[model samples]
Target: MLLRLPTSVSEARECLAEGAVPIGGATLLWAEWQRDGFPALAMSLRGVPQANALGPGTLGAAVVLHRIDDRVPDVLRLAAAGVGTGAVRRTATVGGNLVGSTLRCLLPAALALEARAAVLGPDGVQETDLAEVTAKRPLLLDLRWRDPVASAYIKLPADPGGRPPVTVAVALHADTPGHRRLRVAVRDGYEVVEGAAPCDDNIENALRTLRGTALGDLPETAWDAVDAQVGAVLRAAGDG
Candidate 1:
């Protein structure tokens, strides 16, 4: 089948309606086509709407990963960088990362930041919590999130020679005088964790407790390492 390029979201959805599969970055789709054979009509998002509008952090689905790594907040940059090396990142896109196989980092990081996605489909645009997009993708159009006071992303290395499977991202909001709220997401399939402690200086305990529950299934030694690492991240967030 021929590769089709749509200059706008509406045109892309029309391609989908005509049985074309959308391909952002073409990284994931290309890998699949190489592993299996491509008998499907593919739609490339190269010219889609808002391709690189990072000024407001409005990441278009087609915006390449290298740009995301260089432009977004560190938390998300770390997540994007963790996906692949420099060249691969340049070929991957925001929408592709959101739906990448065995993705254990970016989704959680976006969740921690309270990001939202606008999906465009034959049914039109639907606004959704970015975290929810992981559950069900609808041809991601763009992603947006509020700037947090501070945010951090860390991936615990997988067991020797294995790919990292457990990653965590945390963001803090100091919207109130004495109460500081922390939002976090781990790649453990658990719901986004939210907790509040009294003031920015007091969030260490809250973070420790939340991580403890989420990492409870690990062996004691592993849990200890995770706890210590998370504690450091929380401290850095507070100080930032």
Candidate 2:
């Protein structure tokens, strides 16, 4: 097998034109190709090119989360830096984590950070808001975020109860010096709800419906835990 290591997306594209499946970090994709040591033609992103800031007010795609966590004073950075332990955090690209969906814990925070997904697909390089990107069907390249915002993610580990555990992500911003802003994602079931973060009224309505109609659908223990965790995380984020 020939392995082509590229430093930039363009270089990777050129290698792809030569028939190579791109592997970023290969943290997750490597398992699928482990027996054969990757496909016959594979390009490994051994080292990324010099990462430059993109968009208005200094945002960047290539900046690793470690740098971001140290620089940004928000809960989302804390959540990003804490995802999947140290080894996974070191190897998993923010881009990969974003595309991996709500399971890995970045999607909720991305929604909170006000991050954006930058794509270089068949249609060419384009950027979309992170919240929008998470809900769409597309190939994702990288995630971008603005400076200085607060965000947080909360989830319950899988249990033997046969129910998908609870997961929530909350983010807040200061539009003016003191005007507060918020966004939240609640993945209660197969559907993910995106709207104003900390929608207490909506939560009340949902809870009413959940109690009135969806009670038997979910185990009482699981539902109670999910509700509590979501409330705790939201409270913490609001204080943050």
Candidate 3:
């Protein structure tokens, strides 16, 4: 396998244009390699200064999950911490989670946070909504979002070292004093519901539609937990 280390965004773009697969932490790529063999060309984003940067309102695409903690928003931190084992978390990245095939904890968190992404493509770099970038699966540079007034995340029951079947993330942004806008994002749905807080019926309906399965498949206890968690987050955000 040939690896290209780019020190700047321009170099990274050039490598990408040459058909080098962009790699961040490369945890997911490693899995793909195990099944499908290694690609001929790959570009490591780690060497790029911009891709490693993290700040109050921005998260570099190459930033590892373990690096996301108290410094970031609550919902994001919670989601990142739940991703995988300590070692995996240390190697998995924000960009990989956003575009990987499997469901990742950070996806919902980012959606609820209303994050925007900077992407580098054949044309050039452009700033666009995170949702758009995810859908298009472009080469990501970083993510940016305004700090929320409050945020929360929750996941349903799962084995000690296993991922949950469902997860939810909520963020409250203050539009004006005493008026907070609520945003909720679900794991499988990849859709964000904004404006008013969702009721139990709304939650149930969303789950049913998003999972593409009958609600009866989930136990009553699971529904209760989801309801409770959503309410708790809303209350914590002072929206309930």
Judging by lDDT against the true structure, name the best candidate.
3
Model 1 Cα lDDT, one tens digit per residue, 1-240: 788988877888788898888777776677678888885688877887564466455677787777765467667878887876888888888888786544634777787677888887678878888656777777888888877666777766666555455666767666767566666666643333333233356545765665555444544544454455446555676552
- All-Cα superposition RMSD per candidate: 3.4, 5.5, 4.8
Flag clash pairs in model 1. none
lDDT of 2 by residue, 1-240 (tens): 687866776775677677777554566677768765667887654454423243333333344444555454354565566566677777665555555434545565665566666665554558787655656634455566664344556666766545555566655555666555555554455444444533333556545544444233545654564466445554664541
Residue pairs clashing, model 2? 76-151
Candidate 2: global Cα-lDDT?
A: 0.55
108-199: candidate 3 lDDT, tens digit per residue:
78877888889888888899987687678998888889998778888766666454557767776776675555566666333323323423
lDDT accuracy of residue 114 in candidate 2? 66
Once fitted onto the true fold, the runs of candidate 3 whose alpha carbons sit more than 4 angstroms away are: 159-164, 188-227, 234-240
Work out the TM-score per prediction. Answer: 0.81, 0.65, 0.81
Off by over 4 Å in 1: 159-163, 188-201, 208-240
- lDDT accuracy of residue 81 in candidate 3: 90
How many backbone clashes does every candidate have? 0, 1, 0
Off by over 4 Å in 2: 35-37, 50-68, 100-102, 131-141, 160-165, 176-179, 188-191, 197-240
Clash count in backbone of candidate 2? 1
Angstrom error of the Cα, residue 3, model 1: value is: 1.7
